[model samples]
Target chain A: MTDARDGAGTAAPPSAREAYRDLLPALMRADDRLYCLDSDTGLFDRAAFAGVPDRYLNLGIAEHNLMGTAAGLAASGKIPFVTTMATFATTRALEAVKIDIAYPALPVRIVATHGGLAAGHLGPTHHALEDLAIMRMLPGFTVVVPGDARQAGEAVRQSVGLPGPVYIRLGRSATPDLDARAAGTGPSAGEPFEIGRAQWLRPPGDVALIAGGPHPVLAALRAADLLAAHGVRAAVLNLHTLRPLDADAVVAAAAGTAGVVTVEEHWRSGGLGGAVAETLAERAPARVARIGMPAAFAERVGGQDDLLGWYGITSGAIVAAALNLISGTPGGGTDDPDLSRV
Target chain B: MAGRAPGAPGDPPAADLPAVAHRVREHIVGMCAGPEGGHLGGSMSLVEILTVLYFAVMRIDPRRPAAPDRDILVLSKGHGAICLYAVLAERGFFPVAELAGYARPGGRLMGHPVRAVPGVEMPTGSLGHGLALTNGFALARRDRRCFTVLGDGELQEGSVWEAAMASAALGLGNLTAVVDRNALQITGPTEDAIGLEPLADRWRAFGWTVREVDGHDLGALHRALTQAETDGAPEAGRAGRERPVVVIARTVKGRGLPSVEGKVRGHYARLSERQAERSLAVLRARRRRAAP
Candidate 1:
């Protein structure tokens, strides 16, 4: 596992797909029971699986069968890593995943790509905005959204021994590597990443910016920088694991702060924002300003970054939301419906 | 009775099949009489299929249901879970007395078959997933055989066809699917809901070896299943005949009980105490008339 970051520390890291292509082959080779099942994703190179050709299978463009077959393999003592687009894996094959995998609590890892607005140019038909909510609701499911390529590899490696179904949401484009050591605060600042534990990228301050996925986490870091310029100290938390959430970290982050602001590349109602708010509502009361895609579908199509900016999921939007919460503004806590118009 | 433990290796004598099937049917009828009732029609239709698989066909051990190399049987049409429970109990997977607590509170047996039940390969109340699951089992260990019984009505799901295509494409010769072709679902006749005519041809088109048989005939079912198991063997693979097999078992819904036989109402019913006794009487009369 070579570091994707370069000496300059500004090199664009590999996308989640590239990380899987580099990581899965070795993982499969080390564990004979691990099989890779693809629904014609065409992401991994055939040469990479040359050693384990028999274990790698492309089930064609059938997500339903892909999931069901993975469940069957899991039940038979083989761990199957299923790969497909997020939309198809969640919506198209939802029933199969629920009944065949989640209901039985099988050990099938669904590493879905092009999550959220990653497939923005392909239009709404390809976007997977609702996948997190759907997968999180399934009983015995572990939902993890890796903030970068490195975390994606870690997620795939850690999920191999998990006893139940796991859903790993990934993106289609490259994202900057998120190194907590750069922030130089929190006890876990330099510790290795662990699933279900939040990574504190900055010291606790007046407000905490909580987010998951590649762009949102990076945006949260940038928002923390922007908040520093405004003389308001802000903490950035990479809440990669949605299920089995790090509620303790969330509650602690909200203890002395004005409130917490959540950012994600998904719908405002679910995903990281909903998970944060739901945890805080019961454990600790805090004002939350959720910055994400609105309830309506994308009215205009663009690249991943363009769509994120248009939907108010950028660092600037996060700064605005944090400032509003600090000032005790009433309507700033919820999603801004007017952002969808742009 | 054969002097061997239940689910012991080797097939029981052919003469014993009818008696075993008869007892299984009795168990189903009795269980359905419980307050919740069971999927009477589908369960009754599956009596011979389950009996033949558990008794004369598959390689399974009641004492070691999870043996690494043992054959697998998934009741894909999980509404017919009662038939599987009855057959498993009779085969010594569990005590037959446990059948009484089925669908009752605190009972391990639910309306759908789950892994909690012994000898059930996978929980499959949802239609259209069994074939794909069997494909997985077959692919995981090509040496062992895997089987699943799907309802004829379950063919309406597009996922079934998706699995059908995959089974053939993967050349999973160690896999066999038996369709309980009772030709009816809860809504009405399968044809009325969605016609699956030329069913055998459809399976053949999906690259499978199709064998249509009378589901009630123990001899035919036994033969079809045996041939399927043999055909799936790697050594039995001919030059161009390495294909998965589907045994279409044509059966009548609610076969033994004359009142609900071949009727829509037989799909599900809560039998009164009198109704249960009457149904058992009809089954006994049929057995007596068939005897020498």
Candidate 2:
């Protein structure tokens, strides 16, 4: 289902849309067992989710209403999945997420689509670069960014049965299939990966590498090859759940290796790196280098690769940052404040 | 407390309303005093309306609040919570003694009405949320039966307008929004805070069957409620449609207690024990004068 485009026009990824459609039946049939609250007429689009369906509610563009309603439904003993765009759900409906979902411990799976720069033409109004930062800040919220269509489906399936609040970010396009080598290996590859744990895609040694979000998986793979060529034995970590992060793994890797390199599509401050830094500081603080977009909104718009490179979140950038950090030399790109006090 | 039509002043001998109102007021005062904090003025304002709704208009079973057929009442102005707790307790939804725990630490009776509390429909301290939830309940019972009470001050929220538009479009006749036009909010007079003077005209413009009544007048209130019950006949019969009804009830910020009645400053003002005592005395005198 991967559609390789040499930097072109914007269209809904066939795989993403198909996954959403396929999941509709499971959502509807769950009945009182599963409840979904959405902004706009999310229910009207599918046959399964339609018109005041007993277990579902359409809050109509009111993101705050959607979160609060989802909380209310959860309070009434129903598993609620609140669907909305990442930009609006993270930035606009943030308070409701904090007070109602996280604070009250409502079991709501926030299925946020159009994550990062996937919202192409809509410009700054739709771009969700800060979502990871915002989401990972809240306590008890398990943040998951599926790398592709298969991961998205798996994440949704895993999230449905999970307890407490789950923030799932899905990409607009499909990526390459999950590497068969990584399957059935780690704890995450086994019977339903635990909520707060990270997956080690490659073993750690001289330098440690960490990435999050759908785009991060590709960057990690590419960066690993680059690091190997430079005679650096790099271990790649997929920081899927950002909030209740796998701090133990990150600290152990950082403590054993020369240094740690963190990368994400979110702002340098308050994103995945900030979360890891805070965790490590409290438990096992270490010398770490952060790699992400600088603190500024994206004004340029184009294809995913162009956006990635334009924001300096490319594999080459990650490779360079890793080299500098391991060599005990601060790269010019290392400008983000030390988040030890987060 | 169930079958009477709020007013039938002559039929039930006007005497019954005060007795019920007095009990409700007692519960309200006792609840707040226990916690040392509550919307005393707001609760006082709605004592008569709640009495009438429970005693006369609404068809609710004390044994079953969630029973599919029971009349639904949502108190959108959640700050005026004591009135609801008092009325529900008197109706035997829970032990009347539960009112004593209100607002106190280690009490099931929260400052706001939660679902655990019998007869309290939705959890709403937020002003705009209740009307929307009430719209859901009303639309659900489109076959016939549900009522929501919103505060005039709360109607200012934009979400209330959205719910109003949707309710009118859905034609939910089974739903009736009774706005306690007591004209007071936390800050001061509702008009001074946020004008809702043209509130009735606004509801009518939204395509609802509007009825204005003196909230304190048990007779007018009974007639209005009965009118709402009949209004759903045509819409429910139509199947694909329903019309929302709005009852604009004009009431004093503090109705029965002369010490606080019509006082804008008393919207959320606290009363000293002496003032509480005087207020109770005034209510007893009024009850005595109206009795026989």
Candidate 3:
């Protein structure tokens, strides 16, 4: 029996990895220039991968080598999709990502799996709570954290067409499907989903919850529903892209809402929370509350939900933060510190 | 067709290799002794290897440095960047006069090689990255050949070994790496700093076809590098072979200039105008001695 949390034989929504597996055949047929650098993490089924021997390369367990190889391939006119665990790539092969991929602005899509705490009970070592912040720091890098397998798939496809290096953060678990929900009324799904653009899951209201990554966006959607039951009006914005952050969306959300709450499965200092705060502070100053992890390392290990709950990144926490902001008394909405600042 | 026999009609002459190396070394020495004090020992030792690649072995058009099929070289020991820049200039990838702007404010010649330099395939100064990069080029197009030069000291970096293993595993016969096995590093002798004595065995164990050669010996380097390009991957283009070749090039830290040759002091110097004059004189004497 594999724990849904430990990333083996789990029944979650189709993840970015599965989406990639589905999209790869059509993508290969469409463009023969595409290549994959699997870090030998069993990212794809052996049969599907074997059919395209010349287009794929297994870079073994060495993550930095994946980046280096991707650099060379990109230099040589091949579009490489370098895959690895987010923790290893963000922290372990960071220099390679910076020098080899980012510095050169290579058209390499770093589709990082096991992003955030998606590795769950495997503990902090497997978690990638800071991958987005690190990749966002790189100049000319496109940082994306898709909200569902569909959005994740869409982000990957969009990355292929977009120029330069792009880091697509993916969760290890099967997240609940939210694309259909995101595509309906609130912000109008008619707008073609584009990189650096945010999707609206709910209409404008007195308060808005801006979030990124699968878990956080789902939590924001659920939090919006809970807010509605309480007769509170809240808008949910799915911020898939972190760099070239949809500042226009952020500004509009701030302008319409009394206050804004930014949620993510990462540290409050530099992840999606920080990006929102930076945008709101400069573009539209509002009473902003950050719903993210504390500035501490993990000492407790449990399933993804327990870990997310322990860190106060939940629908309950986000709703509480929104209520507090609406009441003009923004403090720690969760068990941790009140990160809201006026 | 790229595999021209040594004395074939259209093949380039290896005789001028030493002369080209001598001139390139002169440029390197002058740059190192200027405002940009550099990795002098490593740069001087690399002249012959780079000369052979650019002049005698590599198939590149100076005007078309970015030709899709041109052979590529990555200098993994990036501290020795002036040597690569000097050679690129002589190869006509850029103007020889641009050498004057090296390390100058707003100059493209950074302390390390950057893509801004026309001929530089990839910017590298960080150790243990070039082999992996060369492997990438090899995998991208099996037809396009790639070479990288690594410092023996850089062998200590685990990333180099990772690339070595991957190259062999992927059967990248189009890729060849030359390790500039100069005994010393920035701190001191590599043995004293961190021993990589069983280096050849390590590469072999990592599944590479290792060849030992004198890095400073022009004829040996020309033969080794040329043979690697020509003999590389006949079956790879046909039946798929998994042997990536690595030439371990043993060299003195600074093989030219008598005063600094083999001396740790030769590793770096911001020579005063007078010292620069003296270094130029030594190169001139060597050129005079070898003149026809």
Candidate 4:
């Protein structure tokens, strides 16, 4: 299902296709949202899930219907992901997510795509920035944001076997290249990913960089390079699972390091950063800086990079923030993790 | 009991009727006073309906709640859980005395129904969520039957309407919704909060076979539930032609205790010990009079 990219640079990055393609079969085989009364908006285009081997129902634009139906399917022993735009999943189907899936602890994985500003030019209504905050308020819901194709693939496969409710945020924008050699998913890539453990990208360092979903990985790369320039040696950690958070690993990393920097594309409240703070505040209290979306909705409309820059969610902003924290520049105001002003 | 023609409009034997209603009311009063707080009015309204479903109509085995073919029941407005808990207990889902734990800390019988409770099909308290669940259960096992009870006030939520539309579209004949229209909510009477006068028409428009019943009457409830089975008799034997059914049950807010029965403020009014004693006396008198 990989879309062959020709010389025209307008094609979506190959890495994103690679990530989505891996879960295509599994999602096709199981996702009941694919077979709802409506048709699936081809936003997550890869495999035409209909006519797939299993009952892969696509409930085309009805996010609420997808969520409610998925709950029923889960109650009946089927693993269903109520797939749709992140905005619709968060806004329209929020009641279903809160009541049907999370509160009841139904094991329905809300595999939301086009998270954050990934739905370029679709305007602010389609952009999903506060979904994490809204979802985290739920008691039993686990929020998972895969950093790359490998992580996304692993999350989908592993989530099928795990218990409880999960909200998986994916992207419509281009994804970063996967460290093919490091990820180790040649032909054996179909194996399930571990759900709650954070993948350590670098050896132990003075500053610990905790990242989740997609934007944080970009921040990790830049922050690592920036930290290297100052001899501050930073360790990058991919926190794919947001709830039932990798508390032990984060505590260990924060305790071992001088400071911690949490990066994400979600609002500062109830997202990866808040989760990390909750962990450290309980297990290992340390100086933690956060980089993520603000609480206010974006009035401007633009492409992925433009939206990220406007929200101070870009890798450069994260790198600068991380360096300032590491160098003790004492960021002008309260280091309260949820500093994003929308 | 094995295979009576469902929904044939008529009164059943009154001998068994008063006994079932008495048992249900006794359970409700005892449980509410024990807990000191409950959706007493709501539960009281649903007593006769629950009695009818558990004792007469629903094809359920108390020992095997998860039986492949067992009829399912979902309490959408789950705050009205006392009636369910009491009925399930009377039917032997668990020890009836456990009703004393209602709303207590660390109690299984919380203010709402939870799936953890052996016979409860789904965890509920949030309004307007049960119908969708009923739709799912029915659609999943098209071969089985399911029933869901919703409060009139709970129908104010848009989700219930969404579920109503979906179930009708799916042609889920095996699913039935029994709306306890007691005319009241936590605030005031339901019509004052949000008009549901066109409620029956709404369900019919949504493609359900609508039946209005005197919810407090055991005979009417049994008849309506039976009538639901033969709604579309031509395709009665067909696999999936059974359309969803909505039984709009007109009930008093509190059916047994005359002091609270039909009182708009009884939805959450705490029953005084004296009031509880009085209600128990009424139930006892009724039992004695109906003993023969």
Candidate 5:
């Protein structure tokens, strides 16, 4: 019933995992019925919930029952946070997620960890590449893949208030906390974490870099800095929440900027790139590039960095895509086949 | 039409259930005689169970079905929705007029229970999910009882076992599940279709406190349910075992109207006008015999 999360020796920056472990117990105190259910993915500390053991039910390996139990708790007037790896939460328990949680509009927060290439060492079978696409198909489902652990914790805290099913995709890696600082690049970054709103780390310039998930957002910021050195002023918009998408920002970025490029660790077909492209195609058609893995299973990469590199979900890929769009040569080698019409 | 919110429902006249069930069966037969016939056998088999719960057992307020302290019921065997609808209307959850819209499009009443229907606690059509869901409801407000009626065939779903395991492990004594053990499924006899013998032992093995009862015997259903709600005292006893109850309600597929009684074809059929008249006449005869 335990995993590698309990054996961590990293002094990594306070992650969303840390924030949730610290803040969730407090939320539980505020609402007695705010129970925590895990699929035996002991990624978080159980001792942290020292006082309320009954409030925490480890559903072992049954992902379907984990979600269905959450729905039952919701129906019974308890707010339950169902946790599991992103792989099981979306695909393995899809029917439960759809019928039990989403269809009923239950107030259950799905705090899924190891999303996308974040589980890189675990290979494609563990990668939740299609989570966002699958979740978007459910009506009234709020999907958020925060840029960092801080945003993730903040999103989780905010999700408790929303009265419907909310899917919060967390990463295995605990990157530095998100800083909404005022001094950085294109746009100001100090936006409070909101469920439906998008946060911009840097403002729009010659081109805008729209990305989500922990690694991809950081990569886009790094790409923006690299684009600046090459005289291509690029902006980074952190689309933390996938559904109830910030279409207006996408449209504005398209209308104001020369071009736009999307980055994510997910497949190029239905990730942030697909969401942005679909929005832009209808609202404002513009030159765009999508930097992501092809519409296929990920390679058997050794580690997270290697997996990101193999799929071209790196800062270099984002910079290259932005530069291609900034110049007149859009749809460079970075464009996905799914984006041919876009 | 305004739904009359009456006082919390009280026990029925102990002697009147047979006649009451007879009338309820007549209503079921009339509704199924139309083009939109329902799962008549499943619903008919459950008439006494629903009658016992609504009239004598459950602490429900039809006027305010959402009362925080009221007992909740989920019909996991969704095919038998017409029977539930009939019981709910008789219990005054909605007006009798709503019965006409059963199985019709753009109406509140449907083949399966939706939250749109006032009395239904959770939407259930796909089997094996009800027990798990009801367990949550029980755990949330352990002070009240959460009951779910499931079909014998629904046990074939792994999700049923999933809920069964959780409910037992958690010792959710505030919850109870009534299995309509008619033995036959939509395809054929459940054992013939998918062997499920040793059913009682399987539930006990899963950690549930199991009980068997004559499902059509209204007095027996009333006794079993009354005993279930009295356990697991409160949240203060969370540390102790709060055993959830599962009542195996033995029944015949078609409980009355002998022409199709216990026959698989009664599962769903559009009764002809003549057949419907004869069925009503038979139920009325049973009513007269039970009345005096």
Candidate 6:
């Protein structure tokens, strides 16, 4: 498998959490209604909030109260950005999000970090593999899984004027910057980033590889390059926004390609793959192969990259899925039924 | 009742609070008599608490419900939404006739409170969320006093304690919480469900100023709320009185309805027309007995 950093620059890309923290001070300056609430995630530096000490609050380890208080602030005409681990935010504080935030449609931005296997080494308890699925199912919620750090900042900025609750999923570690590399190559390249719009990183061709979150998207881009070497042109679609999903983009990608492959660091049942399959099943039917974690928790302890590789969430796995999808195979890539080594 | 003139709009005299509470209870019973039953027990218990807040304690205007500086009240124990609705209507936030539409199809009033109704600061039904929201309001605008009403049963929710810790840690002097200690829940007595016996001690432990009062005593409620506001005032902070206050108002779950008073069945009921009439008669008889 080709490393995502093979030909990339030496400087490491910023993690989505880092990008969000760096953007907080500016966001606070831009809008007086903006406030930051943390559930002791330790993702932010207290020094950045020195000038606006009252605005930045570390609410300790209570995610439930963190979300409810953010909703209350939003109800009082303040836009509160709540930070917590994705698993805790979605699972522990879910009812608070559904009632206090989504039910009233308050403008609370829940920027959850360590989405998917980003916290893999801490074991399955920390991994947020179900965050996207849980958030997307909520009504009046704008769910966004940024493909890179830059897109994460863009998602946070764009969520200000957007009425209602928003859930932004971020990875713990730095991932490749797919947007910078594909800036001038595709038709949708150089266009302004929108919350619900999908970005076409590679031109539509024989197969379409759609993905979201940092690693899955980078893997899709790399998979496109690998497919090109095998004379199999693959299009890459960065479907960042899960809810209020750009169905037109999904349908168009499916219509222009022989098959569609969805890759994500999530369960194959729900997340990005389930959304795309649901879209294509209704709008434009096509052969779809989903590349993601199977129906089991991580059995081995490892870093995010190790867990992803063990689960076949890699560029090589995406290439295999794309080839199998185009060849009309019954099962493709890492959509394996065997869970012996899960 | 004829000798007493109606008080001014926002600041009704403390003398008029009981009459206002009686009318609010009548409205709650009427709404509970509708096709869809309401939370009768909890709503009945909260009548005086909400009545005093809307008619006397809180500074709010029905015409300008969204005034930025206006004091806010969150009905955290949302099952008592009918009680809050009746108080809001009596305070002229909405028409009293609108109470008939409660819990009916296509009506804005659902089982719980929502922002669609005027004067409702936040939509709430799920327990343990109101205090945190109240903390948000207090934190956002330090000048305005914020209040919330919680059920003794609701204290079982862990988030309530979490909010309590945050409230004290932030020194939210402009925040007050009134616990409707009705001693009953949907299942049975609150103590049987989950004991909150040392409830005042719990709040004190959480670093809040605690006060226990008779929830049905409008004057006591009014005094406690006023003192809470004063204690939570910003100037009070300079005077070393910077803690949020909680009034644990001991109340009977079904205060107005004699048949279900303090019974678990009183938690929710869709009263028949006859039952509603008897309940009204009981309230009138009690008022007549207490009259001068």
Against the unseen true structure, what C-alpha lDDT does each candidate score? 0.85, 0.70, 0.80, 0.71, 0.78, 0.85
User: Interface RMSD for every prediction, one decimal?
Assistant: 0.7, 4.4, 0.6, 2.1, 1.2, 0.9
Worst 10 residues of 4 chain B by lDDT: B1-10
TM-score of 1: 0.94
Predicted candidate 2 versus true structure: per-residue lDDT over A49-155, tens digit per residue: 55426655566777765665566456445677778889889988786677657765768789888887776666778778889888877888889876556666777
Better of 5 and 6 by DockQ: 6
Name the better of 2 and 6 by DockQ.
Answer: 6
- lDDT string for model 5 (A206-250, tens) is 888888876777777777777779987777788888888989878
DockQ comparisons of all candidates to the true complex: 0.78, 0.17, 0.72, 0.40, 0.62, 0.74
Query: Interface RMSD (Å) of model 5?
Result: 1.2
The sequence of per-residue lDDT tens digits that candidate 6 reaches over residues A1-342 is: 535332223327677789999999888977889999988877788899867877999999988889888988998899999999999999999999998888888899999999998886899999998888899999999999987788899999999989889999998877767668687767798887789999999888899999988788878888898999999988889999999999999888887677998999898878999999899998888988888888778887888887887777888888887888777778744444456534
Query: Candidate 6 residues B3-77, lDDT tens each?
Result: 122334344444577787878888888888998988999999999899888878788888789999999999999
For residues A1-342, write the lDDT of model 3, one tens digit per residue.
111121222335577678876776567657877887888878776567555766766677999889999999898888888888999989999989999989999999998888887887898898888898899999999999887777778888888888889999888777766656555757656566678988888878999899987778777887888899999989888888999899988888878687999989887778887888888889888888888777666676776767777777888878888999988884643424434420
Write out the backbone clash pairs for model 2: A40-A61, B4-B56, B171-B242, B171-B243
lDDT of 4: 0.71
Off by over 4 Å in 1: A1-11, A180-186, A332-336, A339-341, B1-15, B228-241
lDDT for model 1, on a 0 to 1 scale?
Answer: 0.85
Pairs that collide in candidate 6 are B173-B232
The better candidate by DockQ, 1 or 3, is 1
RMSD of each: 4.0, 5.9, 5.2, 6.2, 5.0, 3.1
Of 3 and 5, the candidate ranking higher by TM-score? 3
Candidate 4 lDDT by residue in tens digits, A124-214:
7788878887877788987787766666777776776668888878887556544532244222233344777776665557888888766
**Cα lDDT of model 2 by residue, B116-178, tens digit:** 787787666767766665665554444545666788888888767767776665566777888
Per-residue error for B23 in candidate 2, Å, reads 2.2
Error of 5 at B86 (Å): 1.0
Could you tell me which residue pairs clash in candidate 1? Answer: none
Which CAPRI category fits model 1? medium
Model 4 regions lying over 4 Å from their true place: A1-54, A58-65, A181-193, A230-232, A332-342, B1-17, B228-242, B287-292
